[model samples]
Target: MMLLALALLQAAATPSDAATEARYERCIDLATTNPVAARSEAGKWQLANGGWFAHQCLGMAYATEGGWSAAAVEFEAAARAAEVAKDKRAAQYWAQAGNAWLAGGANDKASAALNSALSAGTLTGLQLGEAHLDRARVLYATGDLDGARRDLDAALAVVPEDPLAWLLSATLARRAGDLPRARKDIAEAESRTKEAPEVQLEKGNIAAASGDEAGARAAWGIAAVGKGAAAESATRALAQFYAK
Candidate 1:
């Protein structure tokens, strides 16, 4: 173990200061359309000892491919490397690790990793908001409705403009039988953003929860603006929900 540690320590890293800048160039190129390739490319730096940057670039790559498992590994590695390097802002990597774990089907582990991330510091308001969003998603998936709601509310309190936070909050509100809150949040999101098919999808979700098929259809039509995969899924959900 000591030998491996030494090797990890001595390994010719890709240089911390420059790794992020370089990886971002690669990430933007591959992630826009070729996610799988992007992931494989990003994974190359895992053993390079580049700290949080390598992990972040790689995390985006895996997220693009929906390969949460791989993303979790990279993010976890980044967190450890950052901690060892005493990078005070390493909390972001830890948060990414937790999010990846949650996305990868490791619930308890995700929470634990996130706690480690939070230990780093309160970080910026945006970072705190993201932490709450991640925790809420994990808890909601684990069937902890109350916990999810708490996190969502905290996230909204910090950064209400965060689309994902609003969408998740609205979902949880609908689940908690707070249709008015759900509709309000969804409407607020729609009013604030013209892009992001997800905003429309969540609005459709709100309509479906209210059993308003026409409303749901109208919301989905707005979502189909980009005619992307997200839009298709929203259309499919509306179809299925309204068919009943």
Candidate 2:
């Protein structure tokens, strides 16, 4: 009968819902480390549910990998769905939209989305920290050094244990011609995260600035294992140094 068919449809939809949710979580995880794989699986779910999480993940895949155009589409879709969800995840979508805008070089869009994310009031502590960090980076890129400094300060105030704020502070200090402060901050950040090769690279920068050739070489060697693009260039630097 019609009623039996309706009940069966609802039953089938339940498992599909669970599977979609699982796929979203998987996509978020894989997107960071292996975006191609993440997108391949996530695209399948997007064909069905394509809800906030799916759009957000797709957006993240583009933003993080520097594919700005594609990121904008997914992030905008995410923002729309997130507002409709009216749930905790809504703020996250707002942040993603802002980040994608920043990646896309659409400064105004980034600012608006970031403001909305703050206003939404659902961001987790870590999410808020990351948002501040990103906003600060964008501000710096746009030559708003004063604004960038303020945001970095705010992020550090919120999460003193996070090494990234310290790292950013060091870079900012160096750019501002405060080598002493840069050295001190970079040293602290490097000391905090011994396992992170990027920290080693930061330390290497400080060492080079201070003319500690041996120390810089050692740090750069460690940093060569990092995922940063500079890793390859750093290896070349090392090769040139040894060749000398």
Candidate 3:
């Protein structure tokens, strides 16, 4: 799961004026550096009519503290407040809420928030693509493969440079028995970064699916030495392959 606190921070839009922007920036900085203090300050600010930006900072503070559900609530509140003011930031807040819900393992709520974000039609560029990518993840988790595929395609169209999008597209294609597309998309991902363990693991999986055991072993060898879940998975795959 891509629990992206930094991405949420980057998505923060400029406030209406200079003072509001400065305050938001300070709160966000505090949220990252000292979440407890940020949360307290943001709460007081919210009660003092700090508006949507206050809720946004509060959400960031909660996220930094690993309070995904609370962060989601704050983001949702920010979205509603932005909507009431007809602000473009509403879509961004909805997207943040969806991501927080996803991080919290609330797929149903994530889907709802993502739906609102997409329906707003206000998101553009990479933000729009990321929103689609996130929705695709939610759909895939819910067993809606077709929906996931559609959203992935849309994401790829908008963010062709995003290796994660290509990696996911490749994985989905491999799962759906579309080896040709899997190969193409994985190549796109690999071209972007051959060092990524997940990319290497997926490359190994695709190679194994194609009956290329040697190729699989080579890729898995690279992945096994890397870190995190992908490395662990690659190690297991090598064991299973050798046993077979």
| RMSD per model, one decimal | 8.6, 10.6, 1.8
Ranking by lDDT: 3, 1, 2
**Superposition TM-score, candidate 2 onto the true structure:** 0.65
Most accurate candidate by lDDT = 3
Over 4 Å off, model 1: 1-66, 194-198, 208-214, 220-244
Candidate number that wins on lDDT, 1 or 3:
3
**Which consecutive 10 residues in model 3 have the weakest lDDT in total?**
1-10
lDDT of 2 by residue, 20-51 (tens): 66766677777767878767766876887767
User: TM-score order of candidates, best first?
Assistant: 3, 1, 2
Give the clash count for model 1: 0
Clash pairs (backbone) in predicted model 2: none
Compute the lDDT for candidate 2: 0.69
Best by TM-score: 3
Candidate 2: worst 10 consecutive residues by lDDT?
Answer: 1-10
For model 1, residues 92-146, the per-residue Cα lDDT tens digits are 7777778777767798988888778767774567667777777877899889999
Q: How many clashes (backbone N, Cα, C below 3 Å) per candidate?
A: 0, 0, 0
